[model samples]
Target: MYRISVDSSRCQGHARCMAFAPEAFDFDDEGYAFVPDGMAETAELSESIRRAEANCPERAVKIEEA
Candidate 1:
């Protein structure tokens, strides 16, 4: 499975993640980057998600295999 995580402390509401991959990311009321619940897939990784992960200014987006 592919899992995505955003460290709340590190998130600065840049929205780059959401902008890159709206289907994989979103914002909270405070505008922090967050991965919507149950979003990880057992399928392959997506380009948007990869770009989002790589371009996060805070390096907050984390991708892990589990």
Candidate 2:
């Protein structure tokens, strides 16, 4: 399985992940990307995470096998 993690400290509120995967990422009131519940098990979650990680200019998103 793949584990997705986002380092909020590194996030710049750019919303790049939201554009790549709206279902997996949502913007908080401050415009920071946050992952809602059940996102890890979604069928398209992995792809979404991958896209987000790749597209993140701040390199705050990461994916790892667990």
Candidate 3:
């Protein structure tokens, strides 16, 4: 299994990750990407998480096996 992680310290709040995968990433009031607690495991969400990790401009998102 793969887990998605975001390093908020490096996030630029560009929202590109959210645009690429809204289901995998949520934008806070300030437009930072946030992953919900349980959405990581759904089959519908895995590709989106990968896409988000790939498209993050800051390279702040990552997916690793659990």
Candidate 4:
């Protein structure tokens, strides 16, 4: 499995990650991107997820082996 998260400090509310991986990311109240609770762990290494990571301008999207 893999763990996904967004570094809130680095995120600039660009929403690129949401565009790429809507199923895996959501925005907080202030419009910053975040991985919803319990949804961080993913069993599949989806192409959209990789695209989201690559497309994030702020480099806030994080994916790590779980």
Question: What number of clashing residue pairs does each candidate have, in the order they appear?
Answer: 0, 0, 0, 0
Local accuracy of candidate 3 as per-residue lDDT tens digits, 1-66? 667767889888888888778777776788777778875544343666677778888999877666
> What is the full ranking by lDDT, best candidate first?
4, 1, 2, 3
lDDT of 1: 0.86
| Greater-lDDT candidate between 1 and 4 | 4
Looking at model 4, the pairs that clash are none
Residue clash pairs of candidate 3: none
Cα lDDT computed for each candidate against the true fold: 0.86, 0.76, 0.75, 0.93
Query: Which pairs of residues collide in model 2?
Result: none
Each model's Cα RMSD: 1.2, 2.1, 2.2, 0.8
Top candidate, metric TM-score: 4
lDDT of 2 by residue, 1-66 (tens): 666667889988988888888777776798787677666544334565688889999998867666
Model 1 CA deviation exceeding 4 Å by range: none
TM-scores, in order shown? 0.90, 0.78, 0.78, 0.94
What is the TM-score (0 to 1) of candidate 1? 0.90
**lDDT winner:** 4
